[model samples]
Target: MPMAADIFDRARAASRDLEGVTRPAWSSEDQAAADILLGAAQEHGLTTRMDAIGNTYARLAGRDETAPGILSGSHLDSVARGGNFDGLAGAVAAVTALAAIRRAGMVPGCNLTAMGTRCEESVWFGIAYVGARLAVGNMDRAEFDALVRLDSGRSIADHMTDQGLAVDDIWRADGPEIKPANTKAFLELHIEQGPLLMEQDAPLGIATAVRGNLRYGDGVCYGAYQHSAATPRRLRQDTVLAVTELLQRLEALWHEIEDGVDPSAVFTIGKLFTDPANHALTKVPGECHFSLNFGSTEQRSQDRFAAAIAAMTEEIGRRRRVRFVLGDPVGSSPTPLDPGLRAGLLASAQSLAIPATEFATVGHDASIFARAGIPAAVLLVRNDDGSHNPHEKMDLGDFEQGVQVLAATMLDLAAE
Candidate 1:
């Protein structure tokens, strides 16, 4: 456990930004964190390799080399100025567990690989699970080329090239490098990004499902600018008011869904702003830009929310005399974790006398694997301050407990 703590500290220092850690996908900071993990794996006598998309893997050879392997770990990238344990904790826990297994001199029936995935944070490319998607062949070549890094405004391919990855080889591959046929199961251990675990007073959680989302990143409302003082309320076309009305309607819809349909439904407007260059205190605002996100654990809920958004936007736009241009929506269907795998994780925790609970989780790379027909599970460690911020607070003891459960589950599956 000291080794785990040491690796966490080193990763935090390596990726340290202004206040928290920042490891953009395929950036030097991300590579540095991977190096630290791979170094630990090597030190413990494990073999290491990198895929075309820069997903780092440290493998402990099994008794049967040809059999499907058990894959563990999580992404190494972080949101800008985000907490250290959001993604990195999972990777560390994996390598540390493997190290502990090796130190015990126990070789299982199949390989145990600790993976460090790249670009899991959507803040970088406005998409999640880029590395996992490429590894699993879920992403098309065109989608790969179309994605641009938000901050640098460069293509994902450009960023991969800068990191010395084989972009052409990745695009030319017939299938994903990590396939369901060859992978026994995938497990990811990440800190709970919300206050649920803390509120439950539990040190760990076994995920039931990953919430699917509908997101609009470039939604806009346009209206003609007018004199604020002279324009009458009925004559002026106000975009700000129109957007707020849409948001209010969306919130009301969410409340309805939460109360009557799906209790897991949630909505947020993370970003909203008026055009600063053209707007004035005396002039009526002409344009508004915003981001809208809706999530639910049920596909029917997602469909209902999407339908409501279309209807509400039309009515609000017509009444306010503004045009609403909601750019292409992006999202995925809700992914349910493998019931057998979930049971195994829960049994492991129970056997270890670790009091834990099961709950739904936000999106993670585990969803990618599950959708690819590879059984997957997620172990959530408690974090008090939540995630994607500077104040994440995951106790080392809780992390060790999670790792203990992860190692036990891997061992059980590998023996089979």
Candidate 2:
């Protein structure tokens, strides 16, 4: 293959390295992975550090340490067997973007920090957004204590105790240092996950906006179970049947979430379980809790879409009898971007003769920064898929093009 066509070359080691690192539930190979990357970063002459949650950061300081660094990173941990690129791409791309600039001897107005964030996939527990959430102070003790892991049947605090970290540490976000770090704007470039660019035949599209996301829905009904022959449909208080009906209703609402009303929206039943599930033990009705995500919209469309979802919430409660509950409206955010930063990226892509477009799909680590009132936007790349799958692959040719685009964009952004 032509060398420039091999876009993912900078990421080949880190991307492939994911397969060798086995961080199965509750067992972290993250320390080892973080250590390896930390060393790689230091050797590259980047300053490095770790967070309480183990978010590994590498810094390329500009002339001013006084200036808050421009931040670019992605979460490192993956959902069990998750493909390599979902989070890895952003980290590698950010580092490579800096490296490319270094190769061409570009200087900058402020320092740059490339982070490989952790605990994003809930691998060891249902600790989604562990790195960014803590960084942003969205996570706290009461919240952590209240969380339950469906697979493990234990409180997140129980998981924390088992892992040797104090649950109370989650509240440390209010401290002085935490706020400064959190103050920096963050940018993350991720795989589109949907077939947009590949189908559109474009090199990239600037994220004009990202939809905020949240989840809540639990179903549990315990009556009794009987052999299919013995159980009378009307006479039996079939808990299993109840849950089944709920699922069908929820799914219909979900379809409506995506098509019936909010066709530009997204919803997913990401995790779920029904207890009394052991086939060998007892035939009892099970309890199930599942997560839901409503996402996707352009900047101009987010409010109308959110309003529609809010209306659906009332209907969901009315339809489900099994103590249905929705989470406190969380992860809500408006469109945010560094106008100066974004303008440079957009104009640079056009000047470079690279294909570019402007749009936004859903929220990400970048959104976390935008919410914190920082300038940020996502940059899309080709040759990526199945963000958390083990067999995931990245197209090297597309990766190279991403590098060039990123390199050019950064050079322009840092231009005085």
Among these predictions, the greatest TM-score belongs to 1
What does candidate 2's lDDT look like per residue over 1-416, in tens digits?
A: 23222323333344344463334322345444556666666665677887655567877766666766677777666565556566767776777666656556766657777777766665556556666766666666677567676667787566545645545655663562234454344566666666677778876767766665544444244444445556555545444455556556555665655664445555566755655344223343434455555565533334554455455444543343233444554445445556666676677677877787666555567765566556777777654343455655657556656666666665554444
Alpha-carbon local distance difference test for all models? 0.91, 0.58
Candidate 2 residue runs with Cα over 4 Å from true position: 1-28, 141-184, 213-263, 267-293, 296-340
- Report the C-alpha displacement of residue 303, candidate 1, in angstroms: 0.9
Candidate RMSDs in Å, in order, are 3.0, 6.7
Q: Name every residue pair that clashes in candidate 1.
A: none
- TM-scores for all candidates: the values are 0.88, 0.68
Steric clash count of candidate 1: 0
Instruction: Kindly list the per-residue Cα lDDT of model 1 for residues 320-387, writing each as its tens digit.
Output: 89999998899889999999899999999999999899888999999999999999999999998878
